[model samples]
Target: MIDPQQATPRPDAPAVEDPATMPFPLISDISAARWLLVFIIAAAIYFFHGFLVPVLAATIIAFASWPLSRSVQRALGIDRTATAALFVLVIVLFLVVPVTMALLYAFRELQQWIYWVFEVNANGAATPLWMVDLPQIGDWIDEQWMRHIGRPGAIADLVQLTSGNTIASIYRSVLAAGNVAFHLALNLLFMLIALFVFYRDGDKIAGQIDIIGARILPRRWERLSRVVPLTISATVTGMTLIAMGEGVILGIAYWIAGVPSPVTLGVITGIMALIPGGAPLCFTLVSIYLVASGSPLAGVLLFLWGAIELFIVDKTIRPVLVGGPVKMPFLPTFFGLVGGVKTMGIVGLFVGPVLMALLVAIWREWLREIRTHPQTP
Candidate 1:
């Protein structure tokens, strides 16, 4: 009886809402389940705070080495577990073993230095010719040395910082060393275990994270995810290569300048070069030693060489290796390094750059979005 085209729904019929036209709810309308989930997440984070450092370190290491891990796994046609075991073994053999040996050698050197200090303090000695002959500051240094280190029992006073008790101070120092060693061992163990797990299941873990990331940040996840690993790989590789180059180059210079223990000094300088200003401090101290010890020309030359090399590396090499891929600027890289060291200690060196890279990526993303959808005033 009615025209079908003009027919209208009955008044009592249920209405169907169009999802695309639905307005977002206000914050006040958030559900209790979401609040409960957030609380649970916060509680978990609070509880697992202690594992943060080692876990983060492992994560960074895993991310950096993932490509190499994949290549090795594919080449060998091995299962992930075997590949992971081999990876851990390689790290232990190449990194841990060498570091342990270096630490032991350094401890031995420290022991000898301490013994010499004790002997010097027990029996006063004449000022060294080099100290006496040093230009301008020579006399001042000689006088200070005679007062502090050249006199008998002066070293005892230096160690009496805690409650002015020499024995107590030494006891506390030993206790502190043991505590540090224990904690270090635990961290290393946790890191290795975490590394193995990460190596074995990194792909699956990454996939799970991608799923979550998509759900949380549907628009930006792909770009942000790609940026992190590239940034980490670039930063770490750049720093390490620069450090090794500096060490090798400076070690040769040390030898040419007749510096004692050139190899050891090179190793030390290389290690120090990881931190900003560290390499300069090492070379500057050594150069001063050379000048004080009657090789002023060599010292001056060494200082000049170090300055030039540092300038070249900083200006030319670092930007290409570290910043080229991420499209990051030098200032951010420098701040990241300094800030990371300030807040996170050594690990921050890598983490800091990564955070900055993410910031840059997000900024660019926002810019793109703005360009794509300019708002009408």
Candidate 2:
């Protein structure tokens, strides 16, 4: 006689294995196809590493300029494709042409400076009137000037003294320059092409990215979409405008202070201003040169002007423009700048701060989640 509770046995139920009693050996879940796919991707990246910079540059530029492009497209009743093409061409003029012209002008200025050196060497240059008026070390400077640079052929003698392997060094420098130039041109060509594509199809691409983001990070995707583009645009535009302003102001100062090659110096100063502490360094060095050359009033005024102007911009304007929208702190900002420069060269300068901003945002969001729903031990 069977008990009613123990009588039924289901034929459809399969045997379940407990980990403690499993009999079969474990096999890899990742198949041969996955391994082959990864290998191919890695090999492709290695082959195309040089092209990555330009592609990245194009993406960043496209992202930063998107708003303006949209505005122009709307105002002019132009298609995205035409606007993108025009925008890229404008970028070429803005970036490439100015740089090319600056180099050309600087080269000419450099030749002039060199010729001035030769002229000074031949004419037996003397101490200037202003140097004689300097207070404490004027006498020493005057004496040194008289001894070293005041005599004819002093520069020529100095040049001759340091002429070992000159031709070989020049040859090496020329070869290196040529190689660098060729690579740079290739990168520029790729960047322009990428820029045009991004301009034309950026919205479609962005929509796809949003779809992916929603799939992966549903909770955070909306916040990210709002944050990243604004931050990128602010950082790029702010830095560029400020740097140009610094250069123009300082260049005018250089001209007023009787500094030779003021335009060239201004362009160099503007470019340097994009880097932290770079503008001050340029102004300080110029001031020191002016003072050393017996132009005390000019040097003093130039230094004062630079110190005041840069202080205003750095303390008040820059943070408001760059650090305001993202609310990123000073530490991450600095780290981003230094790290980006170390890793990616000039482009990193703009890209780094944005990355740091994104990182900081993500970290804070994660912390918030942990706080709201603390995990049980």
Candidate 3:
């Protein structure tokens, strides 16, 4: 039997020795080497981020379509693989086909215009009246047109210069198209792969995200992850629908006004719909063409159509589609559309507003946190 003073110590009793005062175990050389290897691997990934951008973009695209894919799967009682395939097919038809056709048509028109100019120069005819009446540079254009087309020697020189410039421009455009195709191919491949993985194991992915969030912020990460994807999807869908509506309206107007190349103009109008102040350019050019071709009545009618369409579409249709879904102020939305187009080309128009929305959401969340938990004195 133990004496009362020497009774067994309770398991829950605090240790007499202080952890702070204890000597730490030395790290073994092998363990240190292993840690260094891990650090090096992480550094390599960080440094080569450029190579991973396409993959990241693919992941984002996959995530953005996840809800739609899931919805389709549920509604049709189809497997995830079939749903992903259908989604990709729809993207190809709606997005890829239109863009490809537009580029091709634009290039062909440019080439035809250049050929016409050269042919007119060779025949010693007056320059086209439309070129002579271009805004802001009409006088300068007239002077150059006379010098290049009215005189034989000058026409030869002008032809050579124009041909060289045309060739150079075409070459550059082709190179750009090649680059675009390469990047697009990579993105498409990776996106398909990502979509397959996402569809196959969506719940697993969500579980991983939750685990990561629990390990990291423990409060805000999960919320942000959900919010960001939803915001992006809403913004993209709204903008696409609005732009399509505008395109249809403008295309119908162009056709009604008997505009030559109405389809081409419609395509341009659709593309410009992605920009804040670009639609006016198409309308102005079409109007000028009408007036110079001696159809003042048609020109006036088209100009009016353009103005009415723009006002009605922006006030009624656009607000309903984009503004309603994103809950963004009109002024901010307008600026974001313009600024994004200017900075990031076509894609930025959608990206910019979404980014702004996300920022606003984060700020509001932070403000709420601060209000709820006031600092101690």
| Candidate with best TM-score | 1
Q: Highest lDDT, which number?
A: 2
Q: What is the total number of backbone clashes in candidate 1?
A: 0
Put down candidate 3 lDDT per residue, 301-351, tens digits, no spaces: 888988888787667765665455345565666676677557644455455
Q: What does candidate 3 score on TM?
A: 0.64
Candidate 1 lDDT by residue in tens digits, 221-282: 89778877876677566665577578778988999999976767877787667666779999
Over all chains combined, what TM-score does candidate 2 have? Answer: 0.68
Which candidate order results from sorting by lDDT in descending order? 2, 1, 3
* Residue pairs with clashing backbones, model 3: none
Whole-model lDDT values for every prediction: 0.78, 0.79, 0.68
Cα TM-score per model:
0.70, 0.68, 0.64
Better of 1 and 3 by TM-score: 1
Q: Could you tell me which residue pairs clash in candidate 2? A: none
Per-residue alpha-carbon lDDT of model 2 for 1-377, expressed as tens digits? 99989977678888777989976555444666678778998999999887787887788789888988999999999999999989998988987677657666776786687667768888889898677767898899889887767898776665556775443354356446656657667877998998999999999999999998998789878977876786567767666567778987999899999998998899779867766677999999999889878788899999999999998987888777766433456678778778877877655665676677667766876788789989999
- Cand. 1 TM to true fold: 0.70
